[model samples]
Target: MGITLVLMLIFIDSVSTFSISALTDSRNSTTEKEGKNADIIRSLLNQETIIRMALQQNVHILRKDLVTIQEKLTDVETKMSRNQVECTSAMSKLESRLLILIDENAALTNAIRSDLENCNENQLMSSMEIQQINQTLAGFDLKQDVAFTVGIAEFNKTWNSGTLVYNKIISNIGNGYNANTGVFTAPFGGTYVFYIAAVEYEKQDLGLDIVLNNKSKVRLIGNNQAAYQTGTNMVVLSLGKGDEVWVKRSYGKGFHSHGVPLTTFTGFLIKHV
Candidate 1:
């Protein structure tokens, strides 16, 4: 009986040791599976963090580009606005200049008409006088009367806000004109007829007067608000021997005479006194 009891105790001790060994192996397998799962989860978290950082960087670059584009657009708009204002101002000035030109053209047309009428009257009167003289002097020897005349088509000179002189001569008869001094010195006292035509450059107001012996006789004005303008004047005067006649400009204004025949002065002795 003592031998049987000792064998049973040894068998119980062997079974307890087997059971503890199995439990320890199962615990070790569970710990290894948990570690592998934790490693996989950490890798996935790292990939997610990298993707988030890349996305944030792209968004920041996009924002900066948008700001730059906005600034460029603003600059372009400002330049366009300035150009528009300048264009509008230029158009306004052009319109004003056109209007002034129209008015000046109208004035010139009227003056031309008046001058034509006067010329026609003078021609008719001359024709009538010639006819009368022919009829009165039929079959009679007639002596020609002494006559003097001078004319200039262009001045080709410059004058500054004072007396003007015509230096160009077209026709001089009876040796009565001095082109160097711009004077018509009457050889004898007579009834004299004088006429003047003038043109000026753009944007200039030309105020001129026909001066007889240093006295203003008739005034002529050529307005230069247009591209160019013309003016004319006519006068009849009774003068003594050696009388002087010339042209003078108004005060505080300049006059320009192009090389062309844009200005003229003419005088003739109609009859001796």
Candidate 2:
């Protein structure tokens, strides 16, 4: 019986040791699993922190860019407002100056118009005075400076006793003498002096008369057979306008020498009435 008890005790001891060992192994496995769980949790926490920091940095950069854009917009608005105010002020000043210039121009135009009116009145008064002066001088011989002198251009072989012609003209201030018809028509009522000269050189006697409206006024005679002889005469006449006067050959065949224009007729108005 004691031997049986000893054997049973040994078996009990062996069963106890095996149960303790199983308990120790279970504890160690539980501890290892806990440690692995702790390491996985730490890794997840680090990743979350890195993502949050990156989001914060990006948000800060966006805010700074927004501030810069807002500042630029404000500055542009301020400049535009100032420029608008300046332009309005300049336009107002320009309009005021333009109004002043227009007023001044109108005043100058009025002054010029008034001066022209005064000048026209003075001109009218001067013209009336001139007319009165001209009328007063009309009756008193206004010194009519009328004159003419003519000569024969060529010497003819003989001249018939009708009218003598002076073909060459030295001066004809009044245009009263006609070279083609050899006549002088009085241009105005005047007192005139006349001179006539004649030369005879072809052994002939030459007689010339100053005729007034077909009436004889004076005579000039030259007679020479051996040398040239000249006869001259002068007369003063009071002639009416339209009276005709000329020189004529007196009643015979005559030879008159001319070429230095020696045979000449001259007349002048001494007084005009």
Candidate 3:
């Protein structure tokens, strides 16, 4: 409001000054001549008056625009403040969830250890231990056996041999090994560490392609680089029994095998349980 008053006062002052200048010019031209030059001067004075009026009007509009701009700036600042508060709140909630997950994982690990001590030593897994596994294998029968097209052994049994124990296995794959297929079925409910080895460790490192049952996929190694000898790139996926594991190789590429010449390799599931 105070700024509007100042702008109005400046406009009034400019109009008064222009009026005085026009009066002076008219008196001077009348005293000199009432002829062609005088008419030209009159026309010039009129143009100058029109220009001054337009400038004054533009100045008034500019002041109004400035006020509107200030209001918009205030609104933007308010929204920014609210978004900052929301982001802070979300971060705090996520941090709380992380702490809870860590605690739950620790408790579950302790419970598993206690049960393992009381179980039979030679038995791979007690019937009670497989209850959770059955839950994972829901809608599928554990008593049934699945046939293999690629691998020699029923991997489910190998993977679920023991609750706490996992083994590293070497299998025959491709022309070197008897089994040659893109698909491998999981025998048990545990995670399996699938590794591929190089024949001479000098072959091109055209990484392996691992496809999961749920259509999720990951590349073992990348293109153009040789496979890292003895380096294991794996995923800890929560897969149920009877789930399929596959290795698809591009560029006629295959993974390394153990000292035994299997194109693809298999082993124990590496995990906490």
lDDT of all predictions, in order shown?
0.71, 0.80, 0.50
Misplaced by over 4 Å in model 1 are 1-158, 256-260
Q: For model 1, how does the per-residue alpha-carbon lDDT over 1-273 read when each residue is reduced to its tens digit?
A: 899999999889889998999999999999999999999999999999999999999999999999999999999999999999999999999999999999999999987786566556545754664576456445333332333333344332345555565666666777677777778888889777777766665546777788899899998776644434566676778989999888777632544455556577777766677
Prediction-by-prediction clash tally: 0, 0, 12
Who is ahead in lDDT, 2 or 3? 2
- Residue pairs with colliding backbones in model 2 are none
1-273, model 3: which lDDT tens digit per residue? 999999999999999999999999999888777677788999999999999999999999999999999999999999999999999999999999999999999988876664454333312332433454446546444333322222222112111111111123343322211233345655556544444322213334444445576363555432322222322243446556667766554333333343333333443333312
Model 2 lDDT, full chain set:
0.80
RMSD after Cα superposition, model 1? 10.6
How much is the lDDT of residue 203 in candidate 1?
45
TM-score, cand. 3: 0.32
Candidate 2 lDDT by residue in tens digits, 18-115: 99999999999999999999999898889989988988998999999999999999998999999999999999999999999999999888866765
TM-score of each: 0.45, 0.46, 0.32
Judged by whole-model lDDT over C-alpha atoms, candidate 1 comes out at: 0.71
